[model samples]
Target: MAAENRAFVGSIVVAGAILVAGSPFLMGFLQKWESGKARVLVVYADPLAGGLPTVCNGLTRHVTSTPIIVGERWTDEQCDAEERSAVVAVQKRLAPCFKRPPSQMVFDMATSHAWNLGPAATCGSGAMTAWNRGQWTLGCQRIARGDDGTLVWSYTCKTVGGQRQCTFVQGLANRRADEAQTCGEVL
Candidate 1:
């Protein structure tokens, strides 16, 4: 009975060690799977009238808590600073669950463009305009066409932005570029 108890304790210790060591990888795997399925988990760090968006798949998910009042105003510096801070905070929170560091994440900025054009729309035009200036950064698998006309995947990250915001840009390179550019111009 004594020997059996010792063996059980040893097994439990080994299992605990394994769980601790494997936690990061497990979190990364779960995050990748959730992101792949186009589900974004949004975290809001500010209590003011500001927020940002993170892209899941090629779609944008807003992180705001309330409806944006049209005709409101903010300085360009404020907008930029607020946006940068929000994005960095979100990335930091997600970093632990990523296989690599947050710097290596490939976020889709195009999704931010889409959001500004719709839900996060601004009514004013100026340096401190009432714009929804949310930025995005993440690591993602790039999709490209192969010789057989099938999709090929590669891992990469990119910086995408406009006058007021940015987000992770996912999809084929040429197509994403065109769409992002067009959206930026409109914003």
Candidate 2:
């Protein structure tokens, strides 16, 4: 595999030292926004629409070693390990989608999106398309919204009143807006 593809698969040895994929800022961003600290370290039903049994910095079976059981608890060490594992897994899967090295801002924004949505959704998004085309600002705009001003990923299928429907979430909107603002810093 190419050097970039090897990134996030695991720490790479360079100059006799190991380094992760992105800057420390990326990990801090995830740790802060995903979860501040493992208060309980127990799996709980996430409040987001279509949310899964998430624990420890938004970990799910999709990116975990095993299925998450509701009410089950994990140690701080385990939670921390899984958090790193999940982020690296996401970066490994999504790395191939970038035809070129994206700006740090775009990379962070897209990785955050892929962390929430699957890499498949992110790879197929207009933001990814723009990034691959070397349109950083457009990619950031698409991350905030779609091709239009409508929010790109601020809704999810939520069952309410015995009916499943797409529900708009202000938290998600705010998160995307924050991502856009961060992306704008690079412009």
Candidate 3:
């Protein structure tokens, strides 16, 4: 009886391990099967209208052309070039701050906040922190709702045209009168 119990437990463990190992492959196969049932739709420019076709030949699914659009289908090379240009622009904007040997934690936190909010948000009231060592830290923040039904304090930042900037949302509203003011002042 003891030997039979041990064999049953071992078989159950083996079966559980096999099921776990196969789950990812099973899920992928199921997704593929479901996708196979989807219908294919074609879209093309009206030939009588002349010029290049509004839709590209390789599109695998539905297409619409209610709005006027231009530009040829992007090739991988063009896409890579565009991506490289964007990275270069970001690196250029970040160069000055990077030279100060900024902490990775600080940079990441600031960048993440800037990515979410507009660049002016990084400088705002909630996101700004003053360290005891005389350093200023900026990033996301938490705030309470005011009588106006708005959160008055929040840390936020933004990147625009490859330039990074941050500010408190409320402070920005108050300071908008000063046209010459810019977030670049802090960096």
lDDT of 3 at 74: 44
Candidate with the greatest lDDT versus the true structure: 2
lDDT of 1 at 175: 42
Compute the lDDT for candidate 2: 0.72
Compare the candidates by TM-score and give the number of the best one.
Answer: 2
Q: How would you encode candidate 1's per-residue C-alpha lDDT over 1-187 as one tens digit per residue? A: 1222112111111211211221222223322432443233342222111333333211223433233233334343333333333333333332233232111112122122222232222111110021112221111111122335433321133345634432323433444343333334322
- Candidate with more favorable, higher TM-score: 1 or 2: 2
**lDDT of each residue in 30-126, candidate 3, tens digit only:** 2232122321122344232233233221121112223323443444333223322332233233323322333333333333233223334433424
Task: List the candidates' TM-scores in order.
Answer: 0.27, 0.80, 0.27
- The lDDT for every candidate, in the order shown, is 0.27, 0.72, 0.29
Candidate 1 achieves a global lDDT of 0.27
Clashes of 2: 0
TM-score, candidate 1, is: 0.27
Question: Which candidate order results from sorting by TM-score in descending order?
Answer: 2, 1, 3
Tell me the tens digit of each residue's lDDT in model 2 across 158-178.
668999888788878887887
- What is the clash count for each candidate, in the order shown? 15, 0, 20
Question: Which sections of candidate 2 miss by over 4 Å?
Answer: 1-22, 37-40, 49-51, 158-164
